[model samples]
Target chain A: MTVQARSLVQITAPRQTGPTLLDRMRRSSLLMAILAPLAILIVWECLTRVGLLDQRFFPAPSSIIVSLFALVESGRVFIDAAWTIGRMLVGFVFGAVPGIVFGIMLGLSPTVRAFLQPVIAALYPVPKIALFPLIMMIFGIGEASKWAIVAIAVFFQVFYSTLAGVVNIDRIYLDVASNFKATRWQLCRTIAIPGALPFIFTGCQLGIGMALVIVVIAENFGTQVGLGYLIWQSWQVFEVRDMFVYLLMVSLLGYGSQMAILRLQRAVIPWKKDDAG
Target chain B: MSSDPSTTLDRTGLSPPAFPKIRVRGLGKRFQVGKAWVEAIKAIDLDVQAGEFICIVGPSGCGKTTLLRILADLEAPTEGEVTIEQSDPSNPLSSMIFQESSILPWMSIRRNVAYGLELRGVPAAEIDKSVDRFLALTGLDRFADAYPHQLSGGMKQRASVARAFANNPEILLMDEPFAALDEQNKALLQEELLRIWSETRKTVIFITHSIDEALVLGDRVIVMSRRPGRLKTEFKIDFPRPRRVYDLKANPEFGRIGREIWTLLREEVVGP
Candidate 1:
C-alpha cells in the first residue's frame, strides 16, 4: 500500500498537494537512521557467524543486545546514569549563572572588560581537562572534583559568548534605553539581558557539549557510580556489550540535554525564534 | 541663482521668537578621531519658540545628527550651553526619533510604544489606554502584538513615531526619521506625522539632507556649512498649517523655496 502511494505521488507531484518528496523523506529519516545501523549490524552478525571475525573482540549484534538487556535487568544503568547526570547539572548551573553575570558586567563596562580581558584570554585557551588533576587535588578526589572540572569547562564557553552578545547589541538600542530615562537597573533588564540572550544560548550549547566530554573523562577516577566508570570497568573486565551500553547512555545524555536546552530557549526567548519571517 | 545666506543669524535679526523654548549659545562639539580632534559643529547659536517645528538641513557629513543629538542631551557640547526650559514639569524633557529604527526588536509594537512610560513606572492600565490610542493613531492597531522583524521598513518607522508621541515629551528630536524610506512611504509617513503634529503642537527639531523634506515639514529651515559645521543661514517656511505633502509639492512657491535653500546649501558646501 505504501509503495503504491509513493509511485502515485511521484507521477503527479505538482498537481497533488501531497507531501513533497523531501517531507516524506523527513518522516522516514528516523527509519533511515535506524536502517543504516541495523544493516551494519546484520553484516557484522553474518561475518561473525561465518567465523570471518573474532567473537572475543567483535561480538555479534544479537549477543550484544542480550547483554544490554542483562545490564538493564541488573539495574546498573539507572544508578550510574543518575550519578553522571547529577554531576553535570550541578556543575552546569554553577558555571553558567556566574559566567552570565560576569559576562554582563564586562559587556556593560569597557574598563571592567579591559582589566579582565587579559586574565580571561590567558586562561580561555587552557585545556580544561588538563586542569582536572589540579582540580581533584584541590577539590579532593570525590564528587566535588567531578563537579568542579565540569563547571570550569562550562564557564569559559558561557562567559565569552555572553560578553559577545552584550557587546554586539546595536548602540541605538542602548541610546533608546537612555533616552527613555532608564536607570542602570532598567538598562540591564530592558536592553542588556534580552540582547545577550541569543549568544548566551549559543554558549550554553557549547558548554553542554564540553561538559559531556569532560564529565566522562573526569569520571575515570574519584568516582564509581557514573556511566564513565561503568564504561571503564566494562573495558577492564572485557564485557564489551556492557561498555557499549554505557557509551549509548552518554550519547543519549548529550543529545537529549542539547535538545532540552533548545526547547527551553525557544520558550524563554521566543522572540529570537528560528527566523525573521 | 539664490543669494548667499548671512553667516550669523543673531547679526541679521531674523524671525526672533518672543519666548524661546530652547536657547543655544555658542554651542560646539568636537570628537577625538584616533589622535586628532574632529569638530562636528562649531559655535552654533539659535533659539526655538515653543510649539515650533524647526528643521536643520545640510549636506551629508555636515553634523546635522550631531546637532540634534546635542539638543536631545545625548551628547554634550564642547564649548557652549544648551538650555531647554521646562514648560511642563510633568512631561518628559524630550523623545528622539532616531535615523535608524529605534524600537527594540525583542519588544512587541505595543510594548515598544509604551517603553518610555513603562520605564517611568506609569500604571499598566494607563499604559494600555495611551498605547492603544497611539497605536491606532499611527495605524499600528492591528500590529500591536507584532515584532519589529516581521514588519516592513515604513511600518517600523511608524512604531517609532507612535513611541515618541505616546511618551508626550516636551520636545521631539528627529534625526532623518524618514531618510531610509522610499519616496512614497516617506510622503505617506510625512502626512501621518503632520496630522499627529497638528493635534499636539509639540516642539520639533528635525534633521534632513533633503531641502524638499525640510520645506514640507519645518516652520523654519536652518542651513549649516560642511564639516566643522557652523550654522550658515535660515529660511522661514510660511506655508499654511495642516499642509498636505502632495498639495504643497504641487505649489510653485514650494519649489522656489526648496531651490533657494538648495542653492544656498550648495554654495555653503563649495563656495559663494
Candidate 2:
C-alpha cells in the first residue's frame, strides 16, 4: 500500500518543474565563472601572439598548458600534487582534530577555557608564516618543516571556531537532554557534536584553505620538488609559463579538496542540509 | 458506556491510597538576574495520584512552567522536595514535552521515540518494539523516518508525546505542548491525548495558559496566581472519557467549571 502511494506521487509529480528563471540565471552565472577565466586566458594569448603583450613577462594559457602537459608526462606534476596534498592532509589532521577536541573541552569547562583561550587569542593574530624561518632553522628544509608550518597555520583557526561552536549551542537543548537522563558522554556525542558540526566544518574549510596558502608560502622560503618549489624555480629561471602552470596546479588542487570536504560534509551530516533547505 | 457509570470509575479505595504516586512539598524557585533575585514560585504543595490527569493553568510569567520544570527535575527548586513514590531517579520516572518540539532535531522520529530506552541501555530489539508501539499509539508511525523539520507543529508535538511515553514513564510533565498549534489541530491532538492517557494511565501534570484546554483535559485543574505563582484553587472534573475538546465548551457543565476557575483567575489575569 505504501509503495503504491509513493509511486503515485512520483508518477504525478513533474520531472522537475523545470529550472525556474532564477535557476537559469544561476546556471548563466556558473557559465560566467568559467568564461571569466577563459576570457582572461584568451586575451593574454591574443596580446602575446600580436606582440602587444610580452610572453617574457605574462605567460599565455596555451603555453602554460603545454608546460603543464610536459610536467605531467614526466610524472613531476602528479608526484608534486600528491606530495603537497599529503602534507596538507597530515597537517590538517594533526592541527584540526586535536585543536577541536581541546577547544570543546575548554569551552565546556570554564577553568580550562579561561586558561587556554587567552593564550590562543594572544598568539592567533601573530603571522604563523613568520615562524616558517624558525621551523626551517630547526627542522631543516625537509618534509618535517613543511608539515609543521601547515599544521601550525591551520591549528588556531579551527581551534577558536570549535570553541565558539561549543559555547554557542542552545542551552535549552542541553536542558532537555539532561532531563531525559542522557549521560554526559551521550550528550556530548549525540547533541554537542551534531550541534556544532556546521560551525566546526566552517572552521575546517577556512583552515584547509589557509593551510594551503601558508604551506605554499612557507615552502617558498626554501624548498625543492613541490608546486611552490616549481613556481619558485621557474620564476628564478624566467620560465613564466612554467610558473603559471604550477600556480594553476595549486589553485585546482585547492578547489578539488574544498569540493571533497563539502561532499564529505553532506554524507556525514545529512541533517545539516535539511536544516538549510 | 457502562450501565453503572460509577462501577466503571475504576477506583480501588484502600488504606494508604497508593501514596499519591507523586507529591510536591514547599516548592519554590528564584532566579538571579544580574543584581536582583526574582522569586518565580512561592511555597506551594500539590499531590498527584496514579492515573490522574491534572492541568495547571495560569497567566504568562506566572511560574506554571517553572513549577513543571521543578517537578521534572530539569530545574532545582530554591526550596522544595518532589517525591515520586515508586520511580527510580537514576532513570527518569517522568518525561517532559516542552512548549516547542524539543524532539532533538538531529534525530529521526523513531530515534527520538526510542531515546529514553536508548539511555536506559534497552536492547535494539526492545527499542524497536517500544518505539513502534508508541509511534502507533500516537498515530506517528507513518512519519517514523521523518525529521522534526519535516513535520508540522501538530505532528512534531505528536512525536514529542510519543517519545515521552515510549519509556512508559510513571508521570508525564507537559508544558503547553499544544499552545502553538492551530485550533483545529489543537482540538484533534487534545482528543488524541485523552485517548492515549486513558489507555496508558500514566499520571500527567500539564501546564497551560489556556483555560479551555484545562477544562477539556484536566481531571483536576489547578488555578494559579500570577508573578510569585501560587495555587489559587482547584476544580475536580467529572467529565467522561473520549471527550472532544470543542464539544466540552458547549456543555453547560464545562461553562460552570470554566467560570468557577475564571473567578479565581480573573483578578490575577486582569490585575487588582
Kindly report which residue stretches of model 1 are placed more than 4 angstroms away from their true locations once superposed: A1-23, A26-54, A273-277, B1-19, B269-272
Q: Output the TM-score of candidate 2.
A: 0.89
Off by over 4 Å in 2: A1-30, A137-140, A221-223, A273-277, B1-18, B87-91
Q: What is the TM-score of chain A, computed separately for every candidate?
A: 0.87, 0.85
lDDT of 2 by residue, B24-50 (tens): 778888999999999998978898887
For residues B150-265, write the lDDT of model 1, one tens digit per residue: 89999999999999999989889999999999999999999999899988899999999988899999999999999889888899999998889989999999999888888988
lDDT of 2 at B257: 83
Query: For residues A1-277, what per-residue lDDT tens digits would candidate 1 score against the true structure?
Result: 3444444433544655779887887788677688887898899999999999998888887888898898899997899899898999999988899889989999999999999988999999999999988998899999998889899989999999999999999999999998888998899999999999999998999999989898998888977789988888888899887787788789999999899888888877856646321
RMSD of 1: 8.1
Q: What is the C-alpha lDDT of each candidate?
A: 0.88, 0.82
Give model 1's share of reference contacts: 0.58
Q: Chain A alone, model 2, TM-score? A: 0.85
lDDT of 2 by residue, A23-64 (tens): 887778677688778888788889988888877887667887
